[model samples]
Target chain A: EPEVTQTPSHQVTQMGQEVILRCVPISNHLYFYWYRQILGQKVEFLVSFYNNEISEKSEIFDDQFSVERPDGSNFTLKIRSTKLEDSAMYFCASSEALGGYEQYFGPGTRLTVT
Target chain B: DQQVKQNSPSLSVQEGRISILNCDYTNSMFDYFLWYKKYPAEGPTFLISISSIKDKNEDGRFTVFLNKSAKHLSLHIVPSQPGDSAVYFCAAKLGGYGNKLVFGAGTILRVKS
Candidate 1:
């Protein structure tokens, strides 16, 4: 079974530095998404991407955050400046279609900002 | 946003027994519900899902029951095994082309052998 895969399973960066979390979604899926879970918190949606554009984003996905599908398979989330609170497990997910389709998730990248 | 709620923080069940995980959602517009299983150091794996148009959906030993009237759903794993132990998250999504999923805090299930 094909699965979503992410790079840099664990990332550590300075508080003011930048970080890019990369994901290669399932090849045939059309919609991609990013979600995060702060320790002990529920997984929260960050943004959704389709057709090389952002479909929707949450308040947490402010100016500091941006997503790009620079290539056919690569979907990346970049944080312009990391804050201590930004440390969390960032996950990437994709679905073949919207509405009733189930989104498949990647193993996640654990981003740690000190 | 508290749209989806999984009241139980954890559950323990003996091997070969049935494990029932419950979830609730306050949003009536949410037309789709899904359950995901997660192991340590891994992302959530899609387990099963049900649409609002149906009351139940099953695959193998896993069964999902939805009560639209009460806005509640449950995942039942029969004949549970130790490997089934993991954190289960209940997620809800509105019916649309690009709607995002709202996840609950997740319930930790331990299926002891």
Candidate 2:
């Protein structure tokens, strides 16, 4: 089955540096999302993107965070400044349809900021 | 505030036995529920989902039951196998176009032989 793929399975960045996580959602998927899970914590939603615009975002998705569909197939999340608390597993998901449809997730990119 | 809650941190079941994992949501606005399975170092895998309009949805050995009145849902795995061991997460979503998902803390399930 087709699945979402993310680049740089793991990333290590210095504090205050900018980091961009990339994802290639399923080719036919129309909606994309980014979520993060701190160690021993529940997965938290970051933002959702569709039609080249942000559809929804959580409080966790603050000024430092932004998402872009740089290309028709690539969805990227950029953090303007990485903080120590930013260390977590960032996941990318996509769905073919809206409302009650299953969203498929990528293996995830482990972001470590020191 | 945690809109979705999975009270059990973990569950252990013998092979071939039935394993039931429960979840509850405090948000009545959530009209869709989904269950995902995750192994170490992997992303959450979609197992099954149920709409608020329905009470039950079955897929092979996995079945999902939703009780709208109680704001509760459960995932049932029949004749569980060792490979079924993983962390199960219950997620809820609102009724809209491409809404964000609210996830529970997750329940670690171990199906032992």
Candidate 3:
């Protein structure tokens, strides 16, 4: 079965540095999403992307966060300045249809900021 | 406030027995519910899902039961095996154009052989 794939299984960056997490969602998927899980916490939604524009975002997705579909296959989340609290497991997901459809998730990228 | 809640932090069941994992939600607008399984170092994997229109949905050894009136749902694994041990997460989504999903804290299930 085809699955979503994320690059740099783990990322480590300085507190004030910029970092980008990349994902390649299923080829045929039209909707993409980003979620994060702080250690020992529930997974939280960050943002959703469709047609190269953000569909919706959570309060957690603030000014420092941005998402891009720079190419047909790549979806990326960039943090302008990493904070210690930003360290978490970032996951990428995709669904074939919209609205309450089952989403397929990637292995996730563990971001660690010091 | 947590829209979705899994009260049990962990559960252990003997092999070949039935394992039931429970979940509750505070949101009435959530019409779709899903269960996911996760192993260490991996993301949550889709297990099964049920719509409010149906009371139950089953696939092989996995079955999901939803109680819309009670605002609760449960996943039943019959004849559980050691391989079934993992953290199970319950997620809810509002039907229609709503794309955001609210997930519970998760319940760690240990199916001992």
The most accurate candidate by DockQ is: 1
DockQ (C-alpha based) per candidate is 0.85, 0.82, 0.74
User: lDDT for each of the candidates?
Assistant: 0.95, 0.93, 0.92
* Clashing pairs for predicted structure model 2, backbone only: none
* Candidate 1 lDDT for residue A1: 92
lDDT by residue (B33-82, candidate 3, tens digit) is: 89999999998899999988999999999999999889989999998999
State the lDDT of candidate 2 residue by residue for B13-63, as single tens digits: 999999999999999989889999999999999999998899999999999
Instruction: Say which prediction, candidate 1 or candidate 2, comes out ahead on lDDT.
Output: 1
TM-score of chain A of each: 0.97, 0.97, 0.97
lDDT for each residue of candidate 1 in A1-114, tens digit (9 for 90 to 100)? 999999999999999999999999999999999999999999999998888899889999999999999989899999999999999999999998635379999999999999
- Could you give candidate 2's per-residue lDDT for residues A1-114 as a string of tens digits? 999999889999999999999999999999899999999999999998888899888899999999999888899999999999999999999997644378899999999999
* Candidate 3 lDDT by residue in tens digits, A12-35: 999999999999999999989999
Q: List model 1 lDDT by residue over B3-107, tens digit each.
A: 999999999999999999999999999988999999999999999999999999999999999999999999999989999999999999876667689999999
**CA lDDT, candidate 3, residue B29:** 90
In model 2, the runs with Cα more than 4 Å from the true position are: A98-100
Q: Residue A20 in model 2: shift from native, Å? A: 0.6
lDDT score of residue B40 within candidate 3 = 90
Lowest summed lDDT across 10 adjacent residues in model 3 chain A is found at A95-104
Residue-level error in angstroms, candidate 3, position B49 = 0.6
Specify the CAPRI tier of model 2.
high
Candidate rank order under DockQ: 1, 2, 3
After superposition, the stretches of candidate 3 with alpha carbons farther than 4 Å from their true spots are A98-100, B96-98
